[model samples]
Target: MPRNSKRSTSIRFRIARSTVNYFRLIYQTFNLDIFELNPTASYPEFEKGLLATLKPYRRPHAFLPRTLGFAAAIARSAKSVFENARPIPFNANQPLFVASTTNQKLAIRPIFDEMTTDSFWFDEQCKECVSTHANRLRIPFIPLVMLKALLSKGYRRKSFRHSVATYCEIHGTYLAFRLAFASSRPSCIVISNDHSAFFRTLEQAARHSNIPTIYVQHACVAEHFPPLNFDYALLDGQDAAEKYANKASRSKVFLVGISKYSKSENESRWTGSPKRIGLCCNALDQTASTIEIITTIQKSLPDFEIHLRLHPSTPASEVDKLIRKCPAGSVVRNDAKTVNSFAFCKSVDVIICGPSSMMLEAAMAETPVITVETDSNTDVYGFQKHGLCQTATSAHDLSNLIADIETRDRGAFRKAISYFCEGFNSPSRPQASSLAATLIENISNRQQIPTNWKQSKKHGWWRYSSNEPELEAETTA
Candidate 1:
């Protein structure tokens, strides 16, 4: 059997085994009365159907005499997902790639490895290092396991994979994909951007792939890197373009902003008077220090009503503990409706935050904003260059800045908004998106012509030439 096909078969067998094992565990742990919840009935049915379907196929692991081993693996994978809450979309034949700079082992690789099966691919170094980490942690070696599964399943497909380790590596990854395309051809590519790497990969991927290369913008673009190019860049607003207009090249950036926040029919139950003081809590990173500055400001302005917006990653119990440490009536926990920091920006008068994208979102909402920047520990490229928010250098500075902002004229605040967001408008403004789309479409059209393509030598940073034919000024945007 072909490598890809064999890998797919092995994955199917293992998944079937795992599904059956998971169902058995659920039954053993919970009573029949617990299982009677109709809303949860589909899960059990799906598990059973998956198991029955796989029973006729050969099992991937020969050592496992029964389906119990598969069940254990399923339960473990499920536990991992519940803990992370990050969805891992899987496809047996699709080319998969992960772009990240952090050397630490990621939480999402299991999902991707399983999805790849025998047709799987990744940076060999990353695969080796991450596989070693998994082994050390006693996690199942799912990459090879999935490869075996895919082999049994008879999956045959071509996949090209790469990564962008840091902001600097984004361009290199793009170049690598371009070279890969010039050699071995692939159908399509999908670049997943999670804050750190920026959109450089998507731009290069579009340049290479004969088919559509989708861009899955992982966070609100305004809060992330300066925009570059993307065939179809997903976004929640024009705030990203406004904040990084100088950096954002023309591209077909799409606004499917926060699909999770799409309106539902259900009405909220609670209605209360708006509070005066608001706090945005974040991780202990440099960005979180902005919260510390905001907290200091709230202490001096004792009369203002304070509302705390917690980061999604923070535990509720930790937030409650932080609240208990604060002065009484000075902090209020956010209701479910306004839990996300961006949700709070639209309702608040003044938003004090660190170098978070939330500050940009607040600017997009036309709210007065102050960002506290203390020690140089947490600096990003665009924070200073774009003038996204008023920086506070110290606690006293923050308090004084807040006081000034509180009394500043509306025109002054609007001027600050203009400084941060150059082209504030509705989300539908398509300058960035249109530019990106046109560039990619033109490149794709050029590839269709029968002209001989040329490859340029890869050079160092200073020596790198921007003289490629398609890389002219028009497509560079």
Candidate 2:
């Protein structure tokens, strides 16, 4: 053959190899592995262990298949279990989705078969198996309520077991709900007030259903996670919104106001003293370091009465212990009066917290605030720089900060708060709730795909401006 022919054949071979490699990469990127199972697969072993461990509590009828393939099929079948699981669209006359953990019975009723026995071993083993496999499996097996019920079966001595059981119950309920609603809902939006379990469920549901989901950042927005393919995100401040926007390139991100204390009912009750100081308390044992910082601040400001509100999740006994540790008349036990955090924020003059959403709520209320970071690993400079709150790193710093706050120019602090909140104090201004509602409506409206969209060869969701010139020229002349 001639030299030109030989060169052409060589080039063709190289091109063929490159094409094969490119196709292989694409296949690996999008491949679904639900049907694949190996001999060493942990999911099967976990299922066997879980079934064996939970045998005493679980009904005989609950045992169906022990293999991975069968479990995948059951998970797939569960997708069609509910056809009307989506939330009703919000209308001017209709009420929005209300948060309810109220009839816990409704969520726990499905696990009655697993609540019969008082075997502590069965409960402990079941919880261990569930926690070990929860993050690894696509479908979460143990519901959170079932774990809670098992805990109530009298194994209080095992704290880790009890905690894992509580988590599993919540996780299991979320998983069951996700599988049930997968086929019914076109999309879902999760509104959570800083609960990791709720957020995990939202992510799992979105991934399983291949549906668009949005997360409204309900607290400090600095916490980072690997960006899921969320359709949109709403943040508490512009700085946070911009950070996520740059990081999550595919998602539509917006800087909306915080959502707490937005209701007219709560706003009407904002009658707390102008200079009152509020200290939001967490669990004494879990946040012992935080409580120590609070003690230091109390000693520095003996004249300033600090109103400490216990977290709703903290037990009554824990609150009592915390009160005893603090000076008399320094701790305020208002946990019973308010059902939600926003309601509690209404009566606070100045809020102090440790990476809590209460700090953001205080900012939304246009109140001066301080955020303490006891952990050296956590950075809170963004919160301080944004004028949302003053960041204190130690007990000594907090004590000095409290003293400084008393002498600081009140007018300057008010102006800083106003700038941070973007005029939230104005009587005519709409609250964060209204802003959230409006943004949701707008996004939902734009989410509709065109009827002939399938016929078009275009790849993206948006129209290209470059195509505009061609259409304009064709129509004009």
Candidate 3:
């Protein structure tokens, strides 16, 4: 097999094994085999049947309001339905990208300002703020059709919770995308992350509508998720490009540098005291382990202060519970809004984390990192592999790492971080926002081309190689 194929095969094996294990757990707990799908059924056939059965419930939605504005929007969209109107030409006249979040908006602020473009977000809370700044569209309700589909699909919930979630997402997002683009279609859709099924559906919908989608890397793409054939993917550095070059078309992959949100000072010597260590928290899964490690570190290095910086996505309640368990004045949680992650790096001498993109951010800010390896650290470009940071498999090992931290070679550490994370290698490296904007404009100005994954062989279910034997990997979301 080709190198890419081998890697993908390895990932497939892992996923299949995980699925089997999940079913085994279900069997052991409830003595049920509900995870089984029709072995010989074609995917299209199954989907067609499901959609047809649920189509009836879509009609007779009398509860939905028929306001004049809604009717007017539909009337306006009638032209697009019949004639298939083309997107507005890409130019400096206005923004052609639809940012899904406020952070994404700020990431490309340079492009948005320089091009005299418009931007919008799908968040309700950001509606007022975004409208005052740029443009904000109200999110549409999940159509009755999608709700009915989910209700019918709930019968398969006995199989796994993911089954229901996937069924709802694939349909709900499709409907939302259709409505969002019906009235005002942009030249392209720009999104930050590919982790969500909603983003996958949005990409599919955009392709169907003859619009291109661009994915700006928001984090490390290390997990075995479904293939997303975006028209363009802006990456952080040469390493990032190499990591995803096979996943996307080589032509679609562009090394546009690191995240624009990061403010890494060039040639900043980390002469700060090594006593202050920052612990970066990722998903809720790592909460317990991280707290345990923190406790161990506090006890080992009594004079050192350990600060916890929770991921923006992590629930505040999880942090509160974890903090209550820690010794008073032992671990302090950093407020995200008040303290920027890079700023936190500036304050701390070294940072420790699970598998999070913040490691790259911290590294960019010239903060040495020590990654704690656990069952959930699935990042392909893990810290230890790239020589960017130290790794410890257990709390005991981590305690030793902290004790011997002063012996690390700072000169070599800075070099490794710059080599792995683009833009930080030198002050002359290309900036992310400008590079991304140029690629976006270039793609939009030309004819829209289908992505490579659209033409390649796709696997069934979560979409892996169908012929490959099962192996061990993380379960699909």
Candidate 4:
């Protein structure tokens, strides 16, 4: 071919690759994932992490097929999506989406149930819930969005491919909700999941439509959690407020204590040396380590009765595996999922835990929780630094900590709770659910934000009040 003809063909190929798919993928990747950047890191470190994706060589072309394939699968999965889901819109009377976990559903319900506004419990299937009002969120689809996203570019690294696939999946998610919002608009949306793709899509859609978004803290967070960008956020305590403070300017943060609990419901501490111990493990823990933790504890504290509690996500097979691995003198139980965490806290004098939000929950219940690193030494929740719990590096360390806990006055835990929680639900103040529900109702009515939530003029963060009780004196480990 002539040089001119060859050059023309190359230009066409490049242009073909630069269609809507490539641009949208790049744009949304930056727009959405920027929030996921670590706020706790210093300026230079933060800048480096944020710009990693946007490096001149990322190409971003390989993302097209993954996004297109996902979008096509979604479209094909529900042949009559328009009939069963796509045409559907938000709950007309009270728009609520429960796209999070069963536990989050439990955390969010108390506040949602308090609202006179019509809302419904939603599971992943988009089925009509059994609420007094038949609340249903009709799944809606927008073909154009997916079509545009599928329009063309083509590969690089495996890790990069997986990351792009996830980001593209959210595009498909965002498009469906975008169409749904246009169908029948609601006054506001309430959510408890900030970490999920679906919930984040709904949040992004709601913001685009100028609809108010309310976030209730269903669980504890890490330093890596996205900033509080919701229009209204009901936080569990000061720990959360501080973690998200750097990026929370746009969000109105209410330091409502954990909404799931009502009144000061604490476990009754034993008057003498502890007679029972609970060993709790989450999915993050390895079975070998779990067995070792329990066996070591049993050997170290031979007189104490030990109960093993597996997380809800633990499979039945895993449970059986755990039971078989239990030490001869120890008792293995998987009933922790059936009973509430607070109830589990009450069942034992002290808890030896893996990295879980339950550490804080158990602490709030006045249960002495000792965290042990089962899989890795990483302190995911900062329980030890915050003074809520004692950290044990090994099974032996935990055994010694258990003995110390026997002699230590449990009142020292009260100060730790203050650092994390405004207060356990109490008669002295409104419950977190009530405060959050009132705020939601007021916002729905287009009324002024209640004066009780004050924004700091200096830092621009909102707080329910600064009248929190002073921290009790620090106790030695």
Candidate 5:
């Protein structure tokens, strides 16, 4: 007994948990956010700190812009300082509920429409959001004194300025939502993304009101996403489900396929030999590096033309910057969001991009994708590790990779993209929206609440068990 007592009895947590707690502890200590609060906005800051530690160059931003935005937001909220707490503007008792992002409005629209006609939905409290769209709903902003206290506590150290400002926003917004939900009493909350601190705050307030939450996968998943802790999660396929489970997801998972996309025939663009290269760029991409990747590839493949597809959300000035700096062979096109995505994917022989869900979309379109890493740092989705696509580290590496694939059959290069999404090519399969809508409706009705992972004998629809540990069955000797 004495010999065995030498070992430590203290509990040990996983590395990721320890890392998150480290950042959370920093927030608590500096902001004095004890007893009086629980915060969710610290997630992004944790990510910034972790990423900066992992990749030194991508450090927490320089002081210039962060300070400006912090000051601006504080000043902007002053106008609403006299405003009183407002309730959600709706005819009281409608609880068959859901919430979505303004950016994802188009994708979520069909799902919402399937849920009900003439439903009034609201976006997050961002000033940029229209607040009221198709059927407008305005949620009132409530004034709070916590901002002043947080701001005062923040000036103790100039370096913690950004963190203090971020907390003020999160706490303030959370109180407003809490005030609203306490009165509204919605039975459940459904959301498309959890990465946003505001969304996480909404979930917190909903839980405070004893309301259940549902999550739908709106974009690609990676190792860095927060754990899936919603009451229910409708995932795209096994890839997303497994990733969520590994992250210790607490939800009852469902593989409802990609709710936004439907089966369609892609336009044929390849004729005789391959000629065009489509480079996809969105707001999330690093501009200088993406431009460098495209420019280098243009010079390498002189025989082929390059087309740059700028996402719709990209700024008007970005078009000018890309066009002026890029090689003459590169043509910048800004209508990517306006046109059909599948058709645009088919317009190129091979697609080149950084880590984005577009790689999976290209696979659905049956187009070959080459994911350019440019360095060891930014492969956020691990496409190469998953064998989902071919990765190139530098311009020279990318150019050589392109040369080898330029003449190869497109069919041979296509990766198994179905692992991330389900039932895209098969027209006979039911669409993800209808299935998701039915499930949502049933959940709202409090009927057939499932306990474990099971599949429908009829269509093989996934019904997951919340208690099943993802890898409980597998044990190594």
Candidate 6:
């Protein structure tokens, strides 16, 4: 080939790669899977962990007595068997997707059969589930969803391939709903959130069937969010309600308290001894800046031990590289199994990390929390807005804060934490799973959602959806 022709082909290839990544970046921003970047990480392992984190854990089912109108809404798999159920059709050439263990566990416990995004495990039991309740288990076809996504205005963007991939995922999910309710409709559909493309498609399908859809809060909704387009949003607490409830969204918000995964073991306590400082790193992209802050803190507090808690998504190799750079015996990485982050925070005198939900975790653990941010304006989880922790803008500021932590009076900090905790967590909160079950039952039983459970939409919901608006078209740099 001519040199000019070769150069043009190379440029086009670069643009295509960049376009694909450009769309992927949106999801990555919320849940940064550092492992995905590593060449050796298997997609199965990555998918499993990601699904595990997102899976809704078991909780209390509605336990109202027979005397009251509200009876228990529990359903056992054995009692609800569909032995000769027909299978939802899809391409036989494509692999059958199995429900994850997490999903399977939930399916056995909850009264309702769940419809969630597939993480690609097609086990024998799931095959049996398809055989038993084929109507509820629609096999997803990529081509159908992709085609629908390509046609929808909501899925179109400046780039073609990336948008199609995302839309297909969403549309495929919609098709599952379409198939499931072909002859029969669900009483209601309960989802973790409506931010993702899959959930959005499910929501639309449920809406079409006149079936109510509920949105369970999954993360911190601390201001600047999109309009929530759902029948209801079951929030974690008043904090989530205050931030997410709005006028334009036309969605109801219920304060359900902390999510199952976020429910602390309730063993948090401060020993009041200056020994270890826990550093929960989330600023992976700013690795050089993080290392500089760590080194400075180590130099300033030579005697104090530092326990670095890496994000679960961060690769061990990257952590190993960081460990080698830190002072030997001075800084140690946290073992996720051995060290409970909340427990670690409680045992330590103080905690340091980039602006993230970790700050809130540390605060809940009753430890003094300090955030190190390059951007002075950044306030993750409203730590600064609520005056819940200390903030450091540079390595100098972080070192100074670390040096003075011992002398600082933390009574007010603890007090603020107590107030903050009260609002964020429901008063006398029940087990998350139990609360969720009761909420679902109530909604399905035709109970009117409280009018008070409403909020003003300062931000829209598109931020977390595939249909989120695009930035001006730009190619790979």
lDDT of 2 at 79: 52
- Stretches of candidate 2 off by over 4 Å are 1-211, 263-276, 284-301, 328-330, 336-339, 371-377, 391-429, 445-477
Point out the higher-scoring one by lDDT: 4 or 6: 4
Better of 1 and 6 by TM-score: 6
Specify the poorest-scoring 10-residue window by lDDT in model 4: 129-138
Give the per-residue lDDT digits (tens) of candidate 2, residues 311-424: 677778877887786656666567733545555566666677754456666655545577776433233325566556687777788777765654444444444444334323
Q: Kindly indicate the candidate among 2 and 5 with the higher lDDT.
A: 5
Clashes within 3 Å, all models in order: 37, 10, 6, 5, 3, 20
Q: Write the per-residue lDDT of candidate 5 for residues 183-290, one digit (tens) a residue.
A: 565556677766665566666656655677778887777665668667888888877777666666678778877776765554433345567777888666677877
Clashes of 6: 20
lDDT of 3: 0.55
Instruction: Report per-prediction Cα RMSD to one decimal.
Output: 19.2, 17.9, 17.6, 11.6, 13.3, 20.5
lDDT of 6 by residue, 1-477 (tens): 999999999999999997875555333322322112220121233223322233322222332221121111112223325445554443322112222334223322332222132212234643454334422222223333334324544213112222233332333344444555544455665565444444555566667556777776555554445457678666655456555555266676555444433344554344444667887775243567667877887777678788888876677887888778766776777865456555677667788875566676677666778877653235535667666788787778877777666555555555555433423233344444445555566676687543423333653221111222323322222
The superposed Cα distance between candidate 3 and the true structure at residue 175, in angstroms, equals 5.2
Q: Which residue pairs of candidate 3 clash?
A: 13-471, 14-472, 14-473, 94-117, 95-117, 95-118
Tell me how candidate 2 scores on lDDT: 0.45
Best lDDT among the predictions, by candidate number:
4
Instruction: Rank by TM-score, highest first.
Output: 4, 5, 3, 6, 2, 1
Question: Candidate 3: TM-score?
Answer: 0.61
The 0-to-1 C-alpha lDDT of every candidate, in the order given, reads 0.41, 0.45, 0.55, 0.64, 0.59, 0.51
User: Pairing residues by index, what is the TM-score of model 2?
Assistant: 0.51
The regions of model 1 sitting more than 4 angstroms off are 1-209, 216-275, 285-299, 335-338, 406-422, 425-477
Whichever of 1 and 2 has more lDDT, that candidate is 2
TM-scores for every predicted model: 0.42, 0.51, 0.61, 0.74, 0.69, 0.60
Q: Which candidate is the best by TM-score?
A: 4
Q: Which lDDT value does model 2 have at 109?
A: 21
